[model samples]
Target chain A: MKFLAEINVMPQKEILDPQGKAVKIGLQNLGINQVSDARIGKHIQLQLEAGSEAEANQIVTDACKKLLANIIMEEFEFKLIQL
Target chain B: MKFLAEINVMPQKEILDPQGKAVKIGLQNLGINQVSDARIGKHIQLQLEAGSEAEANQIVTDACKKLLANIIMEEFEFKLIQL
Candidate 1:
């Protein structure tokens, strides 16, 4: 089966996100003061072929651990759907 | 009321994603050949104050148009949840 994985890699909450902070400031500067905070991260979409759903899950998890996310500073989660 | 918006800004399909291509090559180098393609984009979370859901939606849509997305090179979508 073919599957698509939508992965989100986000900085750990305890870590400071300079990019997000900058975005918040930018928004405020644009006169959008209602925004209290912003957090920025990566959205990765993967297209892969797998024999089954379980196999697809395993592949995506390994990809996240090995390449997609920096476990030390960022965490990742993904939803896999058959395509 | 307060709302949180989970936004994704992605390169338009016609555009090339060098970052994602790099990731795909890296994954293949690591022996993960099942992945056929990859695309990387931005994930942003915004925490904001609004009077109602409709108002919050308008605020977020405006943010996307004015700043969050380039509109020319990329496209964006977001989900807003009351907090």
Candidate 2:
């Protein structure tokens, strides 16, 4: 089976997201003052082969935990769709 | 009313994403051979105030077009939710 995974890795609440803060300021400068807060993260799309749905889930989870996300400062979640 | 926007900015299909390529290689080195392709992009979460849903959409769209995304090399989309 073939699968597609859409993964998101976001900084933990306690961590400071300087890039996001910069973006917020930039938006404000552009006169979009309605914005109050902003956070930036990574969005990853993966195409893979797997034998079963469970196997696919395991692969994506392992990928995120082992390499895609820095669990110490970030958290990750993913949605897998069979193709 | 306050709204939250989830935005994604992705490299155009013709663009080469070096970071994504590096990640794919890293995954391969880690013995995750199932993955065939990977692409990386940005995920932004914004908290803002707006008068209506349409107004919120306009704000998010303007933000993406003006600052959050580089329209020439990237494409962006966002979902707005009432808060």
Candidate 3:
């Protein structure tokens, strides 16, 4: 079976996103007064071959833990679908 | 009223994602052979004040068009929620 993992890795709420803050300042300078806070993160999609759904999900989970995300600074969530 | 916009900007399918390609190679080297293709993108969350839902949505759309995404290489989609 082939599967796709749609992953979202977001900075922890307590963490300061400097890039986002910089963009926020830019927006404010543009007179977008309504804008308050902006947070930026990463979106990733992975395609893989697996023997079963469980196996595919497990692989994705392992990937997130080891390489895809930094657990202390960012958190990851994913949805798996057969492709 | 306060609103939140959750936005995702992804590399177009026709675009080659070099970063994703690099990550895929690394994953393969780690023996994660099942991994075939990987695509990376951005996720953004914005907070704003608006008079109405329609206005909030419009503001988010404009932001996406002007600052949040590069239209030639990426595409964006967003969801708006009242806060």
Candidate 4:
């Protein structure tokens, strides 16, 4: 089975997102007002072949902990769709 | 219109990916070898009510340039889906 994983990695809540902040400031200059709290992060799609949904979930979980995300500074969640 | 934007923000080609490199080394330690060149990034899904695909595309492009992406360090691509 093929699975599509979407992952997001951002600074922790207590941590400041300087990149996001800078972009927010830039947006202000662009005349797009009413925008607040702009946070910047990453997204990834993984096409993986697995035996079953359970197996795919396990693989993704392991991948997140082992490779895909930095738990210290990032948080991740994924939706599995068999293709 | 609903648009699914898959974005990747990595160190420029000339820049090194220390985070990805560390993950690569860690994956080796997990005994699931044969993986090389592990690059990490971000994916975002946007549910927008647009008049048409063209308008949606324009919104996405502008969003990327103005907010969703950092042209200096990131690259982005998106797909449009009417929902």
Q: Which candidate is the best by DockQ?
A: 2
Regions of candidate 3 where Cα sits further than 4 Å from its true position: none
TM-score of chain A of each: 0.97, 0.96, 0.88, 0.90
Give the candidates in order of DockQ, highest first.
Answer: 2, 1, 3, 4
lDDT of 4 at B77: 74
Residue-wise C-alpha lDDT for candidate 2, range A1-83, written one tens digit per residue: 99999998999999999999999999989999999999999999999999999999999999999999999999998899988
Which 10 consecutive positions of candidate 3 chain A have the poorest summed lDDT?
A26-35
Q: What ranking emerges by TM-score with the best candidate at the front?
A: 1, 2, 3, 4
lDDT, candidate 1, A1-83, per-residue tens: 99999999999999999999999999988999999999999999999999999999999999999999999999999999999
Order candidates by lDDT, high to low.
1, 2, 3, 4
Please tell me how candidate 3 rates in CAPRI terms.
medium
**After superposition on all CA atoms, what RMSD does each candidate show versus the true structure?**
0.8, 0.9, 1.4, 5.3
Which residue pairs clash in candidate 3?
none
Q: Highest lDDT among the candidates is held by which one?
A: 1
What tens digits encode model 4's per-residue C-alpha lDDT throughout B2-83? 4443444444556566776766677678854443455566544444556678876776678677777667886777776665
Query: In model 2, what is the error at residue B78, expressed in angstroms?
Result: 1.2
Off by over 4 Å in 1: none
